[model samples]
Target: MTVKGVDVASYQPTDYSTKGLDFVFIKITEGRTYTNPKWVDQRQTARDADLVTGFYHFVRPGSMTAQADYFMSRINLVKGDMLALDWEDTGVSNAEKDSFIKYVQKKRPHTRVLLYCSRDFWLNRDTTSFAGDGLWIAYHNGKPGEPGIKHPWRFHQYKTTPMDTNTGRFDDKAALREWARSKTP
Candidate 1:
C-alpha cells in the first residue's frame, strides 16, 4: 500500500483545508529556535479535515533536549500518531544525534519516533543503523516535483491543494482517506 501524507509548515500550505489529506506531519519546532508560524492553524486544519496528524521537530544536536521538550509542550498530541525528528548535518555530532534519538524513543515509547532524511543521509552515513526503528525517506525525481517526498518513500506527500489559495474547495478527501486506511495499522 502507498502511504499518503502532507508535510506542512507556516508558508507552504497556509489556510488550506486538508480535507483529502490522510496523514499530516506538521512542523512543531526546529531545534530550540524555530517554530512554524501557522503551526496552530495547521494542526486545527488537519483535525477539522479529520486527518490523522503527527508533529515533527527538526533536530539540532546542540539543543536536542530543549527541542524535544519544546515539541512536547507545543503540539497537541492527542490526535497525533507519532513524534518525528528531522535532522540535517549542520555541525551536529554523531554522538549528539544518537543521544537525541535514543531519548525520544525512550520517552515516547507508545508513539513511534521516526527519522526523516534524504537518501544521501541514509546511504552515506550511519542512519541505517537507526532504521531498525523506522525511517521516512525523502527522494524526489519529478520535473515539477511533488509536495512531499518523492519516489521511494515510507511516506509520500503525493498531492497538495492550497487551503487558503483555493476558493475554499477541495476534491480529494475520500481518495486520501481510503489510501490512508490501507497503509495504517
Candidate 2:
C-alpha cells in the first residue's frame, strides 16, 4: 500500500493539515540566510494531526558547509525525523550537491537524508553522483512510479497543482514508522 503525504513551504501553508495525510515535509531553511517564518507553527500543527514530520532545505549556489550549517541551526530534529535537500537548480553542480549532503550528514549523523529532485531534472542533469540515504523523486505526471529513475525512491511527489501529493513506497504506515525508527539515532 502507498501512504499519502504532503510537503509544505511557507507559501503553501493554507489548510496544510487535511485528513488522511500520513506525513509532512516542511521547508525549514533556504540557502544560508532564510528560514521559513511559519515552519514552527506548521510543524506543530502537523504533529498535532499525528503526522510524521520531516524538514527540507532549499540549496543555494554557495558554500555547501555554510548552507548545511544554516539548515542545522534553524530546526531541532528528533529521532525518526527525516531531512531532505531540495535540489532543482541547474546552476548548482553535482560536486556541490555531494558536498552539501555530506556536510549535513556529518552534522546529523543518524538522521535520514533524502534527495528531492524531479525525475526530468535528475535525468537531464546527470545527477547520479548526488548521494543520500534515499530518493524523493518528484514526477508531476499524476502517476505512481517513475519509469526510468535509476535509483530506488522512498517517496514520489506525483502531483502539485491543488496540493503537493506524495506516496510513500512502503507496505504500510507501520513499515514507514519502522524505517524512520531504524534511521534515527
Model 2 stretches with alpha carbons more than 4 Å out: none
Model 1 agreement with the true structure over 91-156: per-residue lDDT tens digits: 665566667777876766556566666556656664335631446655453311232323333443
As for candidate 1, its clashing pairs are: 15-164, 16-163, 16-164, 17-163, 20-173
lDDT of each: 0.58, 0.83
Q: lDDT per residue, candidate 2, 42-135, as tens digits? A: 8988878877778999998988888899898888888778899999887778888888887787788888888888888777884454658888
The C-alpha stretches of model 1 lying farther than 4 A from their native spots are 17-19, 143-153, 156-185
Residue 112: error of model 2 in Å?
0.3
The number of the candidate with the highest TM-score is 2
